[model samples]
Target: MRLAHGLDINHPVHKAMVELGKRLEEKSNGQLIVKLYPSGQLGAERECLELLQIGSLDITKVSAAVLENFVSDYKVLSIPYLFRDRQHSYDFYDSTIGKDLLHKGGDYRLMGLCYYDAGSRSFYTKTKAIGSPDDLEGLKIRVQKSHMAVAMVNQLGGAPTPISWGELYTALQQGVVDGAENNLPSFFTSKHYEVCKYYSFDEHTAVPDILLIGTERWSRLNERERQWLQEAADESAIIQRELWRKAEEEALKTIKKAGVKVNYPDKHPFSEKTRAIMNMFKGDSIAQKLIRNIKSMN
Candidate 1:
């Protein structure tokens, strides 16, 4: 059996997937294999999801933020200051609630497999270091294609500009936006550091990259094949998490050598600024209950 997986090869997680294919082939005695479409050869993350819906793609990796539009329950992960830290985020995924969130996309024809570590996102600016929430005033900040992200920026007093990932470097270089938020590894890989020099480690959101199979394609696999694929994905996640940690450390080191100014501003002010945004969830009983549950976790 041959499976096609889509992801940007430049990403470390892609390396783990390649290792997964190798392990899967060996475990199945060369009966199963995976082919990867790197560099968005298939298309952007959203386009890839559409392909999955139409039964034109087999498996793809996407951020939870991108998957939120397809799975409403995923929006809960985007709430600022939701997870206390990195370990907390990892622990949540290992919980039943996390497993529940993965399966929540079944209605959208998505069968969740496992989560790959994507690291926490933070803000980096071109002209100045953000030392306080007040410093974000009037600055044009680029956000991902998620409403929650835009709302967070707005609550912090910055103008939220939604720019696609591929266009962000140019957007910052040409003065289209003053800054953007993303993981440290992305800042180095996308070469956004070349344009944006100051990085403030506010560490707002921790969104995991999801690996999934389309239910359309999943239905065709035999029981043995399904078991093998699931085992391979679970093992690959362990590999991906370790690589992500090393890559983050390397990325921070590389960018700092390239003349970037890094800072650890008082995050309390930023947290206070986004409290109103979190309160919106309290307005609805369903969302309020979910929020309490997330906060209750270890």
Candidate 2:
């Protein structure tokens, strides 16, 4: 059997997953081989997910923020300050709840295999530094496709602009957007730091990149094949986490050396400002319960 995977190859997670394919081929003794299309060869993250749904692609990885468009339950992961810290987020994702989430994609023809550590997202801006909620007023900030992200930015007094990942560099360069937010490695790897001078460590959200296989593709595998595939994905996730941590540290140092200004602002104001976003879900019993459950994890 042969499978195809797609992702932005520049990322450490994708690099680690490529290793997974090598391991899978070895473990299966040539029963299964995997092909990879990195650097958006398949398309952008959202496009890749859509391809999976239509069975045009066998597998892909996407941030939970993007997945929220397909599975509303994933919005829980996008809630600002959802996880207390990195360790807390790791603990929750390794629990039963995480397994349940991975399976939630089945309803959309997406079979989630595992989650990669994506680190925490914070803001980076071009002309001004965001020291407080007030600093965001009137700034057009690029956010993910997730409504939670748009809501958070809106509540914080900035205009939320949802631009494609590929367009962000130009968006920042042409003043189409004043700034954008993402984890350290992404900000560095994508070279957004070249356009965005100030990096703020508000560390608002921690969204995991989920490796997913199309349900049709998954069903095609026999029990033994499925076991081997799953084992490879599980192990790749472990390696990806370590790679993410090291890349994160390196990104911070590399960008600082690139003449970028780094600021660790008071997070309380940013957090307090976005509290209203969390309340928007209160009317829905299911979402409210989900929030409480995640918060109760630790």
**What are the per-residue Cα lDDT tens digits for candidate 1 across 9-116?**
666888888878988887888888888877667777888888887789888888888888898777788888888988888887777877877888888999788888
Per-prediction TM-score: 0.94, 0.96
Count: clashes, candidate 2: 1
True-structure lDDT of candidate 2: 0.86
Residue-level lDDT of model 2, residues 190-256, one tens digit each, is: 9999999999998888988888999988988999999999999988888988899899989999999
Question: Judged by TM-score, which candidate is best?
Answer: 2
Q: Give the distance in Å from residue 139's predicted Cα in candidate 2 to where it truly belongs.
A: 0.6
Model 2: pairs clashing at backbone N, Cα or C within 3 Å: 9-39
